[model samples]
Target: MKDLVIVFPGQGSQFAGMGKQWFDGNRVVRDRFGQASDLVGYSLADLCFTAPPAEVTRTRFAQVSLLVLSYAMYEVMTEDRKIPVSAMTGHSLGEITALLAAGALTFEDAVRLVKARGEAMESCVAESGTGMVAAVRMPVADVEKCVEEFNSGGHDVQVANYNAEAQTVLSGTLDDLKGLTAHLEDRGAKVVKLNVAGAFHSSFMADAVPAYTEALHEVEFTEPTVPVYSNVTGEAHESPQSIRESLAVQLTSPVRWSAIVASLVERKAAVWVEVGPKQVLKKMLTGAVGSGEVHSFDEEPERVRAVLDQLVELKKREPGLVGLCLGAAAATRNRNFDTAAYDQGVVLPYRKLQELSKLDQETLSDEQKQTALDLLLTIMRTKQVPEAEQRDRVESILRRTGDAGLRTIAGALAT
Candidate 1:
């Protein structure tokens, strides 16, 4: 298919009786769940498939159950659909699931890792009275605006997950969450307290990063068979070294879902499938970027069928469109194409030809506009745009169109 993208869920999507669907149909899924239970030194199936509300919802318990169930579900979904994949990506904890899909982690190894990871994250949370909640009905900028002032209110706070434009999550101290909830509601946003137990992806978990790094190194990593976009850097990684570093660093870094979504748009991924229990990413893409063509595995069968119907027609219309893979981006950059087409827009005004000219500060001309893009990029290259300033810097320059300094700055990033 021409347009294929996959997104996986994080910690919040877990529930009791996770593997019931699989266990009721397949013996292999049942056996695997049993093996995971023994490996974790407890019956995960019992707690997940039979336990009461409290224990099943525990952070440690929820993480393992979701991993096993999600992985098994992924396997079943891929059974007969030998659809050629274009690209793959995952969300916070879903990155592990993507790794399994990409052939980097075995199903057994990933389960073991998540089991240990859950224990570590949960044990750390036991010492601190902290939790997480989802804040809705606000843009990314406004959400950050609230959190910036929230730090001054005497609590540790940070953006945990930028799920979409309107649905952002803020993680911080328990009291800080309470304060933000009241303050945000007053601003007309609808904030919902999530059922999570601790401040994941915030500074409260900073103490866990080192042990995570150690755990990451203990396991050997191999380059993925298929490319996967990472959550921490919003870049595609195909090398073993880069994959390991990104996974280890994700403990302290915010989950960059907005960047990941934007990157997919830039790459022209025409279809996305969020392979999980719920349909959050589909709604998120619709709200944030105005595109989805994404469907969940267990999404209402009618909905999934409708999306597949679109994909069928789309593939017939563009059979040769294998997508603008990042490798192709490197190729075009080497051939001087994206910049060339852009350069021609200024130099030749929508023609495909080369113009060899030098730009001077004393003159404002076509070459000047082209070289201006390079100079602005050179300045950005030397100074790292701080986390808080990146969005503003890009936006301010973009809004001030036609001004050479601002146009150059925005063009530098657009390419």
Candidate 2:
């Protein structure tokens, strides 16, 4: 509730036994894994929790597995734990997860979409012989410069992911990644070759675009109920079309991660919860914000409960702390906590709403008060609250405004 954002990690976050506890204990978690397995024609639980490292890490398996686990965790957080999120973002494959959580896509559609995406990317990797490498302790600019210099004459290489301020991943032909290592090391950057099939998020993925776009077109999209940032632009998606376009571009574009983190910070997101199988995103986010603010929920009930409890206490102290609970990361948008706001028959304490929304309580005009109430009603409706309930809450809050016409208008809306 404390101006929090939920982030989902990408493919490499997977490991043997990831999400095993949830699969063992939670029916909802197991059910989701089953759903994914049925859709993908393989046991996702086996791949995510029991498979050999090599097999689980395959691009095709890794993508769907991460989505299933991340969404399961998101389900626990929202339905069971009731955590509130303000915004959401995801890394690479994680971006699909983000879109799912934002209401831009459905679960069945996402599963099919990511499956197609992974297969497409895997085919590209297999056919092109492209690879990826991570460069650490180097500014993103320096990493880009190194790629440009190495690519100026012959080979094709580009920055694949702007992961952090001083860490980036590069993608190119396998030989090109090897070729650039020495020059990067000479510049004091630690370069390690990643064990990935193809150069994802690079021009090598161009062939994967059309097919994935077709899958995307088959899915229905709605504007996000809560702000969701885009990995392509590192900003809040302006509309459903923008989200769709960005998802398509993400196939052959570098992930603008560091910029996304900075954007979240600018938007007043203070605490970051990484909902996935591992702490990969939490570690990266810790570097962006101080370590005290990031929590990683992998499948440990105690750890997950501890973070949820912490956020609940936060909400208790600041009842206005808006929490955007993700129903399913990359599938469902903010759900439970937004209800927590309106369930009280008011969005927030008058003074707190003024502070958070930056609207003056002493505003001069009745029309402005009506406008604010209308916007709140619209948001509650977008969250899909029943019409009668939304209007009741809005009318309850509007009663505090001493304007007769405003209360009458609220009554009219309730009808």
If scored against the real structure, what TM-score would every candidate get? 0.72, 0.76
lDDT of 1 by residue, 46-100 (tens): 8877898688778778777777767776666665444435567778888888877
Model 2 stretches with alpha carbons more than 4 Å out: 299-304, 316-371, 375-415
The local distance difference test score of each candidate is 0.65, 0.74
The candidate scoring highest on lDDT is: 2
Error of 2 at 321 (Å): 11
Q: Please report the candidate that would top TM-score against the real structure.
A: 2
- Once model 1 is optimally superposed onto the true structure by TM-score, how far is the C-alpha of residue 2 displaced, in angstroms? 2.9
- Listed per candidate, the RMSD to the true structure in angstroms reads 11.9, 11.3
Error of 1 at 370 (Å): 35
lDDT of 2 by residue, 167-213 (tens): 89998887888889988998899998887788889888998899899
